[model samples]
Target: METYDKIGINYNKTRKVDQRIASIIEENLQPKGINLKLLDVGAGTGNYSNFFSSKGYNVTALEPSEIMLAQASHNNNIKWIKGSAEDIDIQDNFFDGVFSVLASHHFNNLQLAISEINRTLKSKHFAVIFNADPSLVSKKSWLFDYFEIVFEKAISKYINIESFKSLIQSTANTHVKIIDYPLPDNLTDNFFASGWKKPSLYLDQTFISGISPLASLETNTLNLIQERLENDLKNGTWNNKYGQILEENHFDDGYRFLIWQKP
Candidate 1:
């Protein structure tokens, strides 16, 4: 959880919401001056929460990281609380809308989190975005090959998309429908694409350090990824093999977004 706080500080340095994805989410939002109340669970450093709040929505950010929560409180003009996906204590049927990002993979009890989300949002017209994806080990790439060799660990938190979907369905009442939303257009400009395009030499060392591996895994595993990245860049090995990543328009990773709506 504390790793998120480090992420919060480093977040804006590298993380900005993509405009195209924002457009999709924004379309489903309550129009301006409508005074919609919302919650951003696991809203570390108020990434998307900051954007929603800035748009005049009454957004409350709930996060468990004390350092991240503190920074979120200080940096944003929104309500900040200390909490996790499980055991969220807000009143039932309170928020008009709710959202979370990237944090679902960390949820140890997915059903409880889903139940809490369903319990807290208004009975009808509530919408959410989630994902069902597998825990992946990169075997095809030269970079990840080095990673697997050095770091004897895995990154996926038992990635099981079907199981994740079932957990949400079991907890949610009949009113909720889980639908797959198209990948947001700006995800690339915001995260992977922008970096993959820049020469590895141009990337910041600190930004690289902020990326987290699965908590259940070993830290030594990262050494493989790190060592390989360092070695390949120096030896011109990576550039020769995967230089196209910089020019690539889009790529897919394991994670995908699922939208839950109350109808």
Candidate 2:
């Protein structure tokens, strides 16, 4: 019945953990060795939460969707909690750090959520947020060329990086640092822009459905796009236009990480 329930079990199938992203989060947070407490707001299937917990940090995986949480892997080290970003149930100044990956757009009230995150973190610690900036994403992403509807919807929903920074600044008393986190050509995680270099992978039904924005699209629309893309690939039209990506190991795709620290 939940918004994300439709893709519950299938969520983890394509959405695996990418160490590159994990390492970036860890580096930004700069955890104080083992047993440090961390909070993962909007933790869909607890991918990052599980990874941090395995690294010896006590992690709280906070997710609003019950169906998605039901499918999350249980770990003794990670505590899975059902809650929304606007109102975290935990106590004040309880966590060493908090991070949200590609989930801020889901928050009904981003300022309130940032305030909640700011309130929950220990002073001088960090809260890291990662997402794609719509303005920048429109530049080089091929998804716009294929699935036009999905891209339009995503761009409308996602906040621009500058506006996001300003929102965090207004709501939280933290020093904000913006970091560019471009997707590697062979990224293990199957997020929206992950298939930038590997264009043909987007043709797979299972792969397309696993992506949140595209999954929300109508079946007919998806099928039409797939049909057109398949034809383009068969006739070499795709490579003729976007062949440069095949040689590159990474693409920017407007992915960014915002590190907020209370000082």
Considering every candidate listed, which one attains the maximal TM-score?
Answer: 2
Q: Candidate 2, residues 1-263: lDDT per residue as tens digits?
A: 24477766688888878988988999999777557999999999988888898888899999988878888998888998898998899999999999988889889988899999999999888899988875676544466778667767877888889989998987885558899986787777798789887778878767766677777778888778888888988999888888877888877778999998876
TM-score of 1: 0.78
- Lowest lDDT 10-residue stretch of candidate 2: 134-143
- For lDDT, the strongest prediction is 2
lDDT of each: 0.59, 0.84
Per-residue lDDT of candidate 1, residues 119-155 (tens digit)? 8888665556544342432456433444343223334
RMSD of each: 4.1, 1.4
In model 2, the number of clashes is 0
Candidate 2 Cα misplacement greater than 4 A, ranges: 138-141
